[model samples]
Target chain A: MSEIFVKDRELVMPGDVLAKSIDILPGNGTYRDGEEIISKVIGLVKLKERFISVIPLSGKYIPKPGDRVIGVIEDVQPTFWNVNINSPYLGLLLLGEAVREYVDVTKTDISKYYDIGEIIYAKVLHVSRSGVVSLSMNDPKAKKLRGGKLVRITPYKVPRVIGREGSMIELIKEKTNCNIIVGQNGVIWIKGMNEGLATRAILLIEKESHITGLTQKVSKLLEEGDKK
Target chain B: MKKGKPERLIIDGKRLDGRDLEEFREMEAKIKVIKSADGSAMFRFGNTIAIAAVYGPRPMFPKHLQNPERAVINLRYNMVPFSTEDRVRPGVSRRSIEISKILKEAIAETVFTEEFPRTVIDIYIEMIQADGTTRCAALNAASLALADAGVPMKDLIAACSAGKVDGHIVLDVNGKEDNYGEVDMPVAMIPRENKVVLLQMDGLLTKEEFEKCLQLAKKGCMQVYKLQKECIKNTYKQIAEGDENV
Candidate 1:
């Protein structure tokens, strides 16, 4: 017995209230009070005779093309490098794509130029009609990332870190006195005054990443550090 | 170095947040925490929490695709649409696909797939909440899921990120730090082998910064791996000792 309407894209947790007396997709949800139904969870619809499927939202990551990424060199080959892009699929930094300074890439000595031990920052070129990933480091925004530490977070948090209009990051830099760069691929670089300060800032960033009022909390923490 | 709202602190050499270095968000985790699944685990880093499940040694269908000599590993990495602050569009996005592929590779490397020919292994990873370092936590969660399902893996893989910002480098940057930081490097490793299975980085860094970042990344990855290994061993021991699964 509940009474509330959950529109599409609205978040609904288990046991949350949903308005009653309204019809929903069959198999979408049950009407405990006045036809209340869960928006996404599977349940029986009150007035619908034909079965309508309601698929519960299952969390998963599905990679799309053109998404920028911070990839690690897993293995290097003569012409292409195998990169782990934090996705289920691997990316290829083909000889030509890594160093796009040339034309007719197939005729280049890609191996002598970039080999086994280097990590390049790039973006998805295509998932290919065959589902294989092709990456490019030639784009103006794409370049080789060097001399920095990396941490992995679930791809899910990339948004949170970026915050609304990049607010979260703006706050991190202002407080920790660090220069940070966030990649859509879920990699971050925090360059601060010193290792001690840098480490401290990173710790706080990881800690309050999920809190709504984190900027305030971070400011408070930074002030306390200043006092010391 | 970065700007924020007036109330937001932006001190010289101070962080956007007023906190000092060395502070970390509260962390909590549970393994085989649920009795219903073959294997399941829950882990939280700061505010991010992820749950993983493993199912397999099931049948091989379409007989043609079945391998009489090895197990077929099927992995699906998904993030719930509501796992973050803003709503996520329904269905698979590009990020999930990449994660799925990388994750499959990790499992394929470890699983004794050839031994379980004609069998299948399925791993499902879900994010309950997103804070930061979800991938590292997910890797640990994935390992637990496999172990919980009694899937044999060569090693437990642990992952983490390190980065350089402003002239110094640090480990385990959160969402905020991740966004604004200069250099970001993420890595997944087989701690036992001191070997890497996956690595990624972005942003700008000098050669010196890059080396430090790499060192720190390895250090953090190894430590996380240790914890995962212990967690797995403990869970397995509990099962052997006839302890409760939940």
Candidate 2:
């Protein structure tokens, strides 16, 4: 007999038993211990059919493959540039992956392509088991982000900021008339007429992420900003 | 000059602080006390206060120290000059170094270090006030801080001390009892797994008395564990309740 100890969306601490059954598999932020599925962090319990996962409320961002991230160039080597993606590990952007055009390293300086301290919107190509993150800028959308204020929130709250089907982000973009780029690593770039208004709305969403009626609340906040 | 031991520490079935044999000192635990730290907590056992701050799981420096298989834990335990009645010299003392190593190992046992391989998690524990069982307070604070930082772990570590005072097996030895007590044993364990990760004894006890002391200490640890869980839950509750100031 399988028994679920906690209800869906319940708050659980480390070592708190979530279920007692072999059939129910553990997911992210949770692990199996003997016949019990236990939480490995302080997070909200999420149950999906046969899998149970916990969404962490706080922590450093862990890079995953296929994630879009905004990173600052820390060092430019001969063939690669080290990008600080707001994670424990630095993202390596190889010269070949950074630009489509082939530039002879002997003839041209690599730093000329992406210099230090410049922020770029890129994609994580791979993450090794040892935590080495490889990044690429091959996509048309990937480019250097310029003259915009950067705002950071907890990485876990990024989803709430984006909202369902980009409703929240689209709302902010419409109200503030700004082009916003949100990175999975919690780095956000806002560029346009009302940068301050857009930044405030994004932060408000981060602060009240877990509360109910967030969409309505965010829309109200954006409307209030438009008046002033 | 050596101070003489007290004539008796237990009288009328009560210890010096007027508590029973298996009673712990009044404890208080709080998390997110330090704004700058990734995770921070303060734990208090009566007058003894310990504040711990966790910085990383960030990239490790000095390349050779980096472990490809798991993250390394670096813990520092320090006592402020005014923590005790007499001014403790600033900087790491031999006693603090030894305690730091043991507490680091104890905390490492619970953390899932393999999740963030090639990184180093730094834990700094400061003894703001000194009473007896300071190491236990430090361990408690460190564990809470790790959880507050959202470090994945098997379980939260809880620590407390038990000792023999005037031939009575008592829980949570205080500064006065530590000076005059016949035995002092500090124990730290994972409450859910019932696994002891850290244990040390400063004095000898009969085999039967040792068993009793261990049991008393385990009981005290469970109580502390309950308080830790409550402390963490309360912080989240305030945020979930839509507090504008949080």
> What TM-score goes with each of the models?
0.47, 0.96
For all the predictions, what are the DockQ values?
A: 0.01, 0.78
Model 1 CAPRI quality: incorrect
Candidate 1 stretches with Cα past 4 Å from truth are: A1-228, B1-25, B233-245
Q: Which stretches of candidate 2 lie over 4 Å from their true place?
A: A223-228, B1-7, B244-246
TM-score of 1: 0.47
For model 2, the local distance difference test gives 0.91
True contacts kept of each: 0.00, 0.79
Candidate achieving the largest DockQ? 2
lDDT of 2 by residue, B48-118 (tens): 99999999879999889999999999999999999987799999889999999999999989999999999
Clashing residue pairs in all predictions, respectively, total 92, 0
- Write model 2 residue lDDT over A1-228, tens digit each, in one string: 898999888889998999999999999999999999999998889999999999987788999999999999999999999999998899999999998898899888999889999999999999999988999999877999988888988899899899999988999998889999999999999999999989888988876676678888888988888898
Listed per candidate, the RMSD to the true structure in angstroms reads 25.3, 2.0
Tens digits of per-residue lDDT, candidate 1, A1-228, equal: 323354433333222344554443324322232354332221111232333232222211224677878777778676678886655456787877776465454565555555555556787888743235788887887876666566554344566567689876676667667666666565565555633454454455543343346666666766677677
Residue B21, candidate 2: C-alpha displacement in angstroms: 2.3
The prediction achieving the highest TM-score against the true structure is 2
